[model samples]
Target chain A: MSNHDTHEHGDPIAEIKKVTIILSVLTIIELILGFWMIGVTSEGGRLAIKGTIVILMLAKAFYIVAYFMHLKHELKNLIMTIVVPLALFIWFITAFLSDGNSFRNLRNTYDPHFKEQATIKVEAKEGHHGEEGAHATEAKEAAPATEAKEAAPAKAAETEKK
Target chain B: MSNVTTASTKEAKWWNGGKSPFDVEYGKVMMWYFLMSDAFTFGAFLIAYGTVRFSTNGWPNPNEVFKSYPFAGEGTNAPLVFVSIMTFILIVSSVTMVLAVHAGKMMDKKGVVRNMILTIIGGIAFLSCQAWEWNHLHHEGAWWGMNPFINADGTASSTNFTNFFFTITGFHGFHVFSGVVINIIMLIMTLTNQFEKRGHYLMIEKAGLYWHFVDLVWVFVFTCFYLL
Candidate 1:
């Protein structure tokens, strides 16, 4: 502890307060955007909102890591050691997500059942029950729900044989 | 001799052999790297989630699934309200952790204990909220392979929705659980005057890092599962 005189000479308590406020505000904005997203029906608008949420999410992460975790105050070497390897995530996300998109395209093109499932709209049940009724009907509801779930995979398997 | 001098001088003062390169202790460095590896773990899980979500044609809209709060009755339509509360709890607890670390820097045991206790309370509160949400979902028949909700477009959805939800959130919850345990142990050590005898509360700083990492992970998990 004696050898560690590396922390910046500043009012750390004040800095903590500032960072806390920033994190909270970021979260609130993100929530607002989330609520806005629910009301937005257009695909482009939802994407723009979602993209903003992501940027805000990254900002919140930066504040948490830089201030709360004190990474920004650390030595340059230490910071590089930590941050550089994280670059791997860029390619990680790109490759995986692109592959996923490709997989979806392939499935939709070849897998008849997969395409059919998307087109088949089931009735929206009165799924959410009152708190008092929830407990009583939990068991009764589980039977049909599980039966439907089981039937889905069975149907997929039957389709595969064709 | 000139070449050797140039090479030696190129290295920063802290990087010189007589002192630690990072100007911090080995414990803190290890904790950072541990968190780094842990970040990859979470990243992989989230990426896998993204992969599955992209590959699937339909998904349960989070707004529909997470639209209830505690004591708000079973048919509440309040999306993101409960989760926002949970998010604030974690952020506030993280602030308390910062205070604990700051108090440790000032050698104030009382401040450290108070903040640590508050942090533990926050952790427990978050876990309780999660328990309620999970129970609610379970009641609605959402489990590893069971999903009661349909896709946003009113299509028959895949079980992957419930499957990924449980696995990722469950993993993050496990991290939170472990973080609480670590904080509890730190609390006990503080109470026993262990850091007092050692003349430093570096251990608390390390614990704070772990706790903040837990909070950090929650940011991603919340966005991935609840918000996005």
Candidate 2:
């Protein structure tokens, strides 16, 4: 190939390397931020840390897609073909997440009475031994270790049979 | 073959010195379209995961749940350090893949082969790390069930959340494994001078696109699953 053809080909490999280095540095920063965020107590500080990490991740993603995937060099129509579908999909995600989140909120606030009744039934099923009753009640208040353990074995057996 | 006919049509159009509609090589154009379709599949899976996660009132903190190693009893002390190392390994492999593509462009066969070997090794390491992660997750008492949130009564608040997490990540891991296999094949082909007669290193470039896509998807996975 002539020097002109060489130049026309453009050293995408070199560009890819440059982007790779940037992504590496950003990933290290993400790791540090992730560790640091785990130590933060304040909600605002946590949010800031999360927002920064998410932004950095998106930046890394953009670099890989644009450079490695050669989207930057592609025709405008091709780019739109790839991007528009992604935008539409994000809309679906948003709608589903909003509905799901609302359902969870309703369950947490408005359905506690039904949940308590369910817990009572579970306690009854476990024979309601004095210590076990206390544990079950505590599990209802905190994490439900006993119920998970009991349910887990039964599920495992069923799955094994399947 | 149909492909030959299509190639002939493409050549006839470009043979007359007319601009190709896509402004990209046919192989490259096809790869983009394939990737776009794949992206939609991945997007659907992720959206499903988000729906399930949102439906759960008390999702288990991923940092806590994924922290335990083989022997370490579950506790706050374990901090998912293994995944961090896996992430670093994958990033390094991506860098080596770029270097391989660089060597291919420069027509340095030795450099290409060396870097491809290194890239393949990095890929294997990544696979091993993923295997370890999978084993850890699937072990009994490790709660392979897909409940992102632990209910107050200690049962999974929603099994759907955990199921989606595992299925999506597992599918992505399978893709990585296949990519590594392809990289290995390309590496062997290069060592044997398969591309020497072709007079071009487009295969390396294509593989680089694929390897980079795996890395890109992982970046999103890391954000949505681990960081979020």
Candidate 3:
């Protein structure tokens, strides 16, 4: 194939260095956005930052595929062959996520126990969160939580039957 | 004579039989398609994760879950620090892989060996970091169907968070392990002058493609699980 001959003219090393810089810069931007996101508790602000992160993510993906994977040097038809099929992801993500949201709505409307569980906040222990030292006490505390969880569902079932 | 010329030109077209329309070799084409299928596999996993997260009312804040790194004191409040390091390692390895591919193109065996070794080291380091993170989380009572951390809002959380975390990262770690093995084998072949004898280094190119694909997947996983 002429594929080997096609890319023989360019300075491949220089191209690699350039793309490396681009990828790194993009990742740093993404991390900065991520760290900034952790401190922001506002809903709209978080959404906007998340949207920016996703955009940067896609840009990173493009660099990796187009440069690192050498897809840009390939023929037009070859690029199409790969890119066209990926369009399916748009539909796939939309359908799955929307369905998941719908399922949550349905559960909230129909299942009183499921709705109640989310509203009830667990009391935070004074310290020792998720540490080995806290395991004993955690187990002790979880026992009643489990019993209460089970009791809530049974009560919901009884109410439904009535 | 006109009929003969028309027939000859028709056969010479790019899409005509006896030549690749994409101008690349059959192996590279197959590799691309294989990576495409693998992409779908990972896509299915992350999408499934999204579905579960959407259906659930509360998710454990990832900042609370993945805060500690190696050598950090207990109860350190550093979130995304460890993961960003992991992300950088993978990206640097990917850059090394690209360099190796370029070296292979030049038929510079020493350059190929050097870059491949660096790539392999990077892979192993990334895998080790993953192992530490997994072990640490397990110590915190996180596992399949078990979650110690409550939701971001303090409500009792579902087990799906840890479930997806372990399963997806485990699968990605497996890919990194296999990529490291492939790179080791490539390194050996380069050292042994296998590509020199073959008069081409197409094999390294293919392995580099796989390695870069692994890095590409991590970008998504990091975003979906840690950042978002």
- lDDT of the candidates, in the order given: 0.83, 0.68, 0.83
Candidate 1 scores an fnat of 0.66
Model 1: per-residue Cα lDDT over A1-162, one tens digit each: 422433434778778889999999999999999998999989899889988998999999999999899998776788899999999999999999999999999999999988887887766645473111112234336544434234444333423533
Order the candidates by DockQ, highest first. 1, 3, 2
Which parts of model 2 have CA positions greater than 4 angstroms off?
A1-17, A41-45, A75-77, A106-162, B1-17, B69-76, B143-156
When candidate 2 is compared with the true two-chain complex, its DockQ is: 0.30
Better of 2 and 3 by DockQ: 3
Q: Write the per-residue lDDT of candidate 3 for residues A109-128, one digit (tens) a residue.
A: 99999999889877552333
Scoring each candidate complex against the real one, what DockQ results? 0.43, 0.30, 0.39
Between the candidate structures 2 and 3, which one is better when assessed by TM-score? 3
Distance (Å) between predicted and true CA of B9, model 1?
A: 14
lDDT at residue A12 of model 3 (Cα atoms) = 80
TM-score of each: 0.88, 0.77, 0.89
- CAPRI rating of model 3: acceptable
Across all models, the iRMS values in order are 6.3, 8.2, 6.7
Query: Which whole-number lDDT from 0 to 100 does residue A57 have in model 1?
Result: 92
lDDT of 3 at A127: 38
